[model samples]
Target: MAIKPITGMLRRQAVLDISVALGLGTASGYAWWYGYHVPAVRHRDQFYQKIEEERAKAMGQQSS
Candidate 1:
Protein backbone atom coordinates (compact mmCIF):
# COMPACT_ATOMS: atom_id res chain seq x y z
CA MET A 1 0.00 0.00 0.00
CA ALA A 2 1.65 3.19 1.28
CA ILE A 3 4.89 1.30 1.92
CA LYS A 4 5.19 0.35 -1.70
CA PRO A 5 4.96 3.93 -2.92
CA ILE A 6 7.54 5.14 -0.42
CA THR A 7 9.93 2.40 -1.43
CA GLY A 8 9.59 3.26 -5.06
CA MET A 9 10.26 6.94 -4.44
CA LEU A 10 13.36 6.14 -2.42
CA ARG A 11 14.68 3.87 -5.13
CA ARG A 12 14.14 6.53 -7.75
CA GLN A 13 15.91 9.15 -5.71
CA ALA A 14 18.85 6.88 -5.11
CA VAL A 15 19.19 6.21 -8.80
CA LEU A 16 19.08 9.92 -9.58
CA ASP A 17 21.76 10.68 -7.03
CA ILE A 18 24.06 8.06 -8.46
CA SER A 19 23.55 9.35 -11.96
CA VAL A 20 24.33 12.93 -11.02
CA ALA A 21 27.45 11.97 -9.07
CA LEU A 22 28.80 9.94 -11.95
CA GLY A 23 28.18 12.74 -14.39
CA LEU A 24 29.92 15.29 -12.23
CA GLY A 25 32.93 13.10 -11.66
CA THR A 26 33.27 12.43 -15.38
CA ALA A 27 33.04 16.10 -16.30
CA SER A 28 35.56 17.09 -13.64
CA GLY A 29 38.05 14.49 -14.82
CA TYR A 30 37.73 15.58 -18.40
CA ALA A 31 38.20 19.21 -17.45
CA TRP A 32 41.33 18.46 -15.49
CA TRP A 33 42.85 16.22 -18.16
CA TYR A 34 42.16 18.44 -21.10
CA GLY A 35 41.97 21.94 -19.63
CA TYR A 36 44.52 21.99 -16.84
CA HIS A 37 46.91 19.05 -16.96
CA VAL A 38 48.13 19.33 -20.54
CA PRO A 39 48.73 23.06 -20.66
CA ALA A 40 50.14 23.15 -17.15
CA VAL A 41 52.66 20.45 -17.96
CA ARG A 42 53.76 22.25 -21.06
CA HIS A 43 54.09 25.55 -19.21
CA ARG A 44 56.01 23.92 -16.41
CA ASP A 45 58.52 22.46 -18.84
CA GLN A 46 59.03 25.78 -20.54
CA PHE A 47 59.50 27.50 -17.20
CA TYR A 48 62.19 25.05 -16.12
CA GLN A 49 64.00 25.43 -19.41
CA LYS A 50 64.03 29.19 -19.02
CA ILE A 51 65.38 28.88 -15.51
CA GLU A 52 68.16 26.58 -16.68
CA GLU A 53 69.16 28.94 -19.46
CA GLU A 54 69.30 31.86 -17.06
CA ARG A 55 71.38 29.89 -14.63
CA ALA A 56 73.82 28.92 -17.36
CA LYS A 57 74.16 32.52 -18.48
CA ALA A 58 74.88 33.63 -14.91
CA MET A 59 77.47 30.91 -14.49
CA GLY A 60 79.18 31.85 -17.75
CA GLN A 61 79.42 35.47 -16.66
CA GLN A 62 80.98 34.48 -13.34
CA SER A 63 83.46 32.16 -15.02
CA SER A 64 84.45 34.81 -17.61
Candidate 2:
Protein backbone atom coordinates (compact mmCIF):
# COMPACT_ATOMS: atom_id res chain seq x y z
CA MET A 1 0.00 0.00 0.00
CA ALA A 2 1.17 3.51 -0.88
CA ILE A 3 1.41 6.04 1.94
CA LYS A 4 -0.74 9.18 1.56
CA PRO A 5 1.22 12.44 1.64
CA ILE A 6 0.07 15.13 4.08
CA THR A 7 -1.27 18.21 2.25
CA GLY A 8 -1.61 21.79 3.55
CA MET A 9 -5.39 21.64 3.79
CA LEU A 10 -5.22 18.30 5.53
CA ARG A 11 -2.75 19.71 8.02
CA ARG A 12 -5.02 22.67 8.79
CA GLN A 13 -8.03 20.43 9.19
CA ALA A 14 -6.12 18.19 11.52
CA VAL A 15 -5.07 21.17 13.58
CA LEU A 16 -8.67 22.39 13.88
CA ASP A 17 -9.87 18.96 14.92
CA ILE A 18 -7.16 18.61 17.54
CA SER A 19 -7.86 22.09 18.90
CA VAL A 20 -11.57 21.37 19.20
CA ALA A 21 -10.93 18.08 20.96
CA LEU A 22 -8.56 19.74 23.43
CA GLY A 23 -11.01 22.56 24.14
CA LEU A 24 -13.92 20.21 24.71
CA GLY A 25 -11.81 17.99 26.91
CA THR A 26 -10.75 20.96 29.01
CA ALA A 27 -14.32 22.22 29.40
CA SER A 28 -15.70 18.81 30.40
CA GLY A 29 -12.87 18.31 32.87
CA TYR A 30 -13.58 21.68 34.43
CA ALA A 31 -17.31 20.96 34.62
CA TRP A 32 -16.77 17.61 36.34
CA TRP A 33 -14.26 19.08 38.81
CA TYR A 34 -16.36 22.12 39.68
CA GLY A 35 -19.74 20.45 39.66
CA TYR A 36 -18.84 17.22 41.45
CA HIS A 37 -15.41 17.34 43.09
CA VAL A 38 -15.68 20.82 44.52
CA PRO A 39 -19.11 20.31 46.05
CA ALA A 40 -18.13 16.96 47.54
CA VAL A 41 -15.00 18.42 49.08
CA ARG A 42 -16.96 21.38 50.43
CA HIS A 43 -19.58 19.13 51.95
CA ARG A 44 -16.90 17.02 53.61
CA ASP A 45 -15.16 20.06 55.04
CA GLN A 46 -18.44 21.50 56.33
CA PHE A 47 -19.32 18.19 57.95
CA TYR A 48 -16.01 18.06 59.77
CA GLN A 49 -16.35 21.69 60.79
CA LYS A 50 -19.79 21.08 62.21
CA ILE A 51 -18.54 18.11 64.17
CA GLU A 52 -15.72 20.18 65.58
CA GLU A 53 -18.10 22.94 66.57
CA GLU A 54 -20.39 20.54 68.36
CA ARG A 55 -17.48 18.97 70.19
CA ALA A 56 -16.26 22.37 71.28
CA LYS A 57 -19.67 23.31 72.59
CA ALA A 58 -19.95 20.05 74.49
CA MET A 59 -16.53 20.62 76.08
CA GLY A 60 -17.48 24.16 77.07
CA GLN A 61 -20.67 22.96 78.74
CA GLN A 62 -18.76 20.31 80.66
CA SER A 63 -16.29 22.89 81.94
CA SER A 64 -19.05 25.29 83.03
Candidate 3:
Protein backbone atom coordinates (compact mmCIF):
# COMPACT_ATOMS: atom_id res chain seq x y z
CA MET A 1 0.00 0.00 0.00
CA ALA A 2 1.27 3.50 -0.97
CA ILE A 3 1.35 6.13 1.78
CA LYS A 4 -0.47 9.37 0.96
CA PRO A 5 1.40 12.61 1.77
CA ILE A 6 -0.47 15.38 3.62
CA THR A 7 -0.85 18.56 1.52
CA GLY A 8 -0.13 22.08 2.87
CA MET A 9 -3.79 23.00 3.11
CA LEU A 10 -4.62 19.76 4.94
CA ARG A 11 -1.80 20.34 7.38
CA ARG A 12 -2.92 23.92 8.08
CA GLN A 13 -6.50 22.80 8.55
CA ALA A 14 -5.41 20.11 10.97
CA VAL A 15 -3.36 22.58 12.98
CA LEU A 16 -6.25 25.03 13.15
CA ASP A 17 -8.68 22.36 14.28
CA ILE A 18 -6.33 21.20 17.02
CA SER A 19 -5.75 24.77 18.20
CA VAL A 20 -9.47 25.45 18.40
CA ALA A 21 -10.09 22.22 20.31
CA LEU A 22 -7.37 23.03 22.83
CA GLY A 23 -8.62 26.58 23.35
CA LEU A 24 -12.20 25.46 23.92
CA GLY A 25 -11.07 22.68 26.23
CA THR A 26 -9.05 25.11 28.35
CA ALA A 27 -11.97 27.57 28.58
CA SER A 28 -14.46 24.90 29.62
CA GLY A 29 -12.00 23.51 32.16
CA TYR A 30 -11.49 26.94 33.68
CA ALA A 31 -15.22 27.52 33.84
CA TRP A 32 -15.80 24.21 35.56
CA TRP A 33 -12.95 24.72 38.04
CA TYR A 34 -13.78 28.33 38.92
CA GLY A 35 -17.58 28.20 38.82
CA TYR A 36 -18.48 24.68 39.96
CA HIS A 37 -15.48 23.47 42.00
CA VAL A 38 -14.73 26.72 43.86
CA PRO A 39 -18.32 27.30 44.89
CA ALA A 40 -18.69 23.70 46.07
CA VAL A 41 -15.90 24.23 48.60
CA ARG A 42 -17.35 25.17 52.00
CA HIS A 43 -16.30 28.44 53.66
CA ARG A 44 -15.38 28.10 57.33
CA ASP A 45 -16.70 31.49 58.42
CA GLN A 46 -20.04 31.04 56.69
CA PHE A 47 -20.51 27.59 58.18
CA TYR A 48 -19.51 28.72 61.67
CA GLN A 49 -21.76 31.78 61.46
CA LYS A 50 -24.75 29.65 60.62
CA ILE A 51 -24.04 27.32 63.52
CA GLU A 52 -23.59 30.19 65.93
CA GLU A 53 -26.82 31.82 64.83
CA GLU A 54 -28.74 28.56 65.30
CA ARG A 55 -27.24 28.04 68.74
CA ALA A 56 -28.11 31.55 69.80
CA LYS A 57 -31.62 31.18 68.49
CA ALA A 58 -32.06 27.90 70.38
CA MET A 59 -30.73 29.41 73.58
CA GLY A 60 -33.04 32.42 73.26
CA GLN A 61 -36.03 30.15 72.75
CA GLN A 62 -35.13 27.98 75.75
CA SER A 63 -34.58 31.01 78.00
CA SER A 64 -37.99 32.43 77.03
lDDT of 3 by residue, 1-64 (tens): 9999767988899999999999999999999998887776656667888999999999999999
Predictions in order: lDDT:
0.95, 0.98, 0.90
Model 2, 1-64: lDDT tens digits are: 9999867998899999999999999999999999999999999999999999999999999999
The clash count of every prediction, one per candidate, is 0, 0, 0
Pairs clashing in candidate 3? none
Candidate that scores best on lDDT: 2
Q: What overall lDDT, based on C-alpha atoms, would model 2 receive against the true structure? A: 0.98
| lDDT-better candidate, 1 vs 3 | 1
TM-score of each: 0.59, 0.78, 0.56
Estimate, for each residue in 9-53, the C-alpha lDDT of model 1 and write its tens digit.
Answer: 888999999999999999999999999999999999999999999
Model 1 sits at a Cα RMSD from the real structure of 3.5
Runs in model 2 deviating more than 4 A are: 1-6
Ranking by TM-score: 2, 1, 3
Best prediction by TM-score: 2
